[model samples]
Target: MRQERAIRTRQTILEAAAELFDEFGYEGASTTDIITRCGLTRGALYHHFPSKESIAVALVDAQSEALKAPERDLGLQSLIDLTFEYARRLQADPILRAGVRLTVEQTSFRSPGSRPYRAAEDAVYRQLQLAAQKGELLPGLDIEETTEFIVGAFTGVQLVSHVYSKRRDLLERVSAMWRLVLPGLAVPGLLLRLRVTPP
Candidate 1:
């Protein structure tokens, strides 16, 4: 019974921390704030999480895992749909948006050796390479360079969207990015129509 209680307590602390961190950002939030929000003592928070950085890592880990689901299918369309869906969710969810914002704004607070990001990046690279091998992508395109470009472009769009808009129409922005990028990367006459209609 005590073990179960401890697990519940830890979950509660993590949940509360996720909410607070998402709402207020990393530097904006403090340990006392989380403790107050969770109605738990600092000791309880510490017992569950060694530090704020740990909580951030946990949140990123969870998000990254969620992002990995599409890689299992190993299809180009599946990957694109999954990524777009994730961007849509991030745009809609304040907590997610805040997390992304925190990661981009506060580089020093981010985990130094985060496995989640690296794993996700590797999965994406593998998927692209596989597509190239199967002739799904254009011939002669450097798989490594293209993967890096796509990842950087997607991250840049998310950051720019967060800065310029309220994220209500992030899908539109993502679509715009796709229209511009996909045409170049895709094989001639094979660029799939973007789902996001122009506003």
Candidate 2:
């Protein structure tokens, strides 16, 4: 179908762009590079993305795709699972890698730099809210504050893992992060049930 083909073409362009962005950062990767990498005509790249910034924005937005965790009970455990999923994807997904790269190097693009962080924090907040209702969270813990801290911590951990190990140790780093963070966030009993390692 035409729609299917269009969707595939758009994904192809995005993936090719993601590779370039991952390799050279946002400002370093150009439209010509994406065209050459994808072996697509200039018109095709232009048709999908009007400019390099647009492609950067698209890749940055795609960062959320890495946040897709399997459905589970909303609790501290689910939050851990969500983070582990993100770490695992960061190790393996090129699109996510590029999105993260663009997000971290936001000054290179003309898009809103905070958008991706806001989206990620929102997801964390949702899980924390549900965990609160389930009595899995620690008493008197502020969900918003905890969400912000957790997202920030994960960001830092992943950045370090990427820098030192090309993210090869990202899963282990995230597991360690949860071990340090869960005690403050989860109720003592709930902590016993939580699994920090990636599934």
Candidate 3:
């Protein structure tokens, strides 16, 4: 019970910090803001996170949660589902929002050797590798290069959506992104069968 309470306290502090980071960006958010937001004492906040940068790093690491999609046959569709799931989470999850925001604002937070982008790239790379094994991807397509491009493209799409409409149109934008990229990535028959939109 004590362990559970400790876990909950850590989550509470993380979430309160996320909310502040989302609203104010990394450099703008302070430990005081998080403590006040969560109604936790300075000691409690510092006990969980030594500094605001540690809180930001925790949020950045938490982005792995956003990559999770329901387990399904690993293929191009699974990869597509992953992106849609991420977009959906971005629309709803404050922690993910703050993480993405901090990832782009790396100059401000500066978590050394923190490879937030690599996590997404590795997720996409794994799916692409599976797609290759299953013959879902186009022949001669380089999985490594494709993984980088797909992750990079989705990053741009979501960032633009966040900037323009606060991600209100993120799902639509993701569908459009798949539509344009799928033709080039998947084989002809598989491309036609793939659902561009979220289920």
Candidate 4:
């Protein structure tokens, strides 16, 4: 029972920290803010995460695991579903929002671990490679380059939506992004079959 309570306490701290990081970037968020947000003592917060950076890393790791790619038939739909699935999560999950924000600032943090960006890139890369095998992708499109481009584009779209609309229009923005990117990536024959919106 004590162990379970400890697990819950750690989860609470992580979530409160994520919320602060989402509202304020890494530099803006402080341990005191997170502790106040969680309504937990400083000792409890430090018990789970020694520092704000540690809390940030924990959020990144947790969000990374939560971002499982949606399963789909190996084709253009697979890639489309992958993007929409993550976009859906981003719209709903504050922890993921914070994690993505941290990933965007990974270079500035200069801390250990590859973080969420690498995980997202790897997931997209796998889907792209599968599309290549199924001939769902455009001819001569390099899977690695295409994966990086799609991931980068998705990141840019999310960032723009967050900045301009506070993510209130994120779903529509992601749908639009898929519409613009798919025609170039999906095979002409498969274009009509791939739906930009959630499946």
Number of clashes in every candidate structure? 0, 0, 0, 0
Q: Is candidate 1 or candidate 3 better by TM-score?
A: 3
Candidate topping lDDT: 3
Q: How much is 166 displaced in model 4, in angstroms?
A: 0.6
Which lDDT tens digits does candidate 2 get at residues 1-199?
A: 9989889989989999998889888878889899999889999888888998898888888887776556777567778899888888788888999988878874658765688999999889888898899888888999989989999999999999988999999899999999998889888877777788887
TM value for model 3? 0.95
Q: Please rank every candidate by lDDT, starting with the best.
A: 3, 2, 4, 1
- Give each model's whole-structure lDDT: 0.68, 0.86, 0.87, 0.80
RMSD of each: 3.4, 1.2, 1.4, 2.1
The deviation in Å at residue 186 for candidate 4 is 1.9
lDDT of 1 by residue, 7-119 (tens): 88887776677777777778777888888888998888898899988877766666664465344333455456656777877865544565565555545575435454465
lDDT of 4 by residue, 59-81 (tens): 77766665466677755677677
| lDDT comparison, 1 vs 2, better candidate | 2
Clashing pairs in model 3, backbone N/Cα/C closer than 3 A: none
Q: How far is candidate 4 from the true structure (C-alpha RMSD, Å)?
A: 2.1
Global local distance difference test of model 4 = 0.80
The TM-score obtained by model 4 is 0.90
User: How many angstroms is residue 64 displaced in model 3 relative to the true structure, after the best TM-score fit?
Assistant: 1.1
Single out the weakest 10-residue window by summed lDDT for candidate 3.
Answer: 105-114
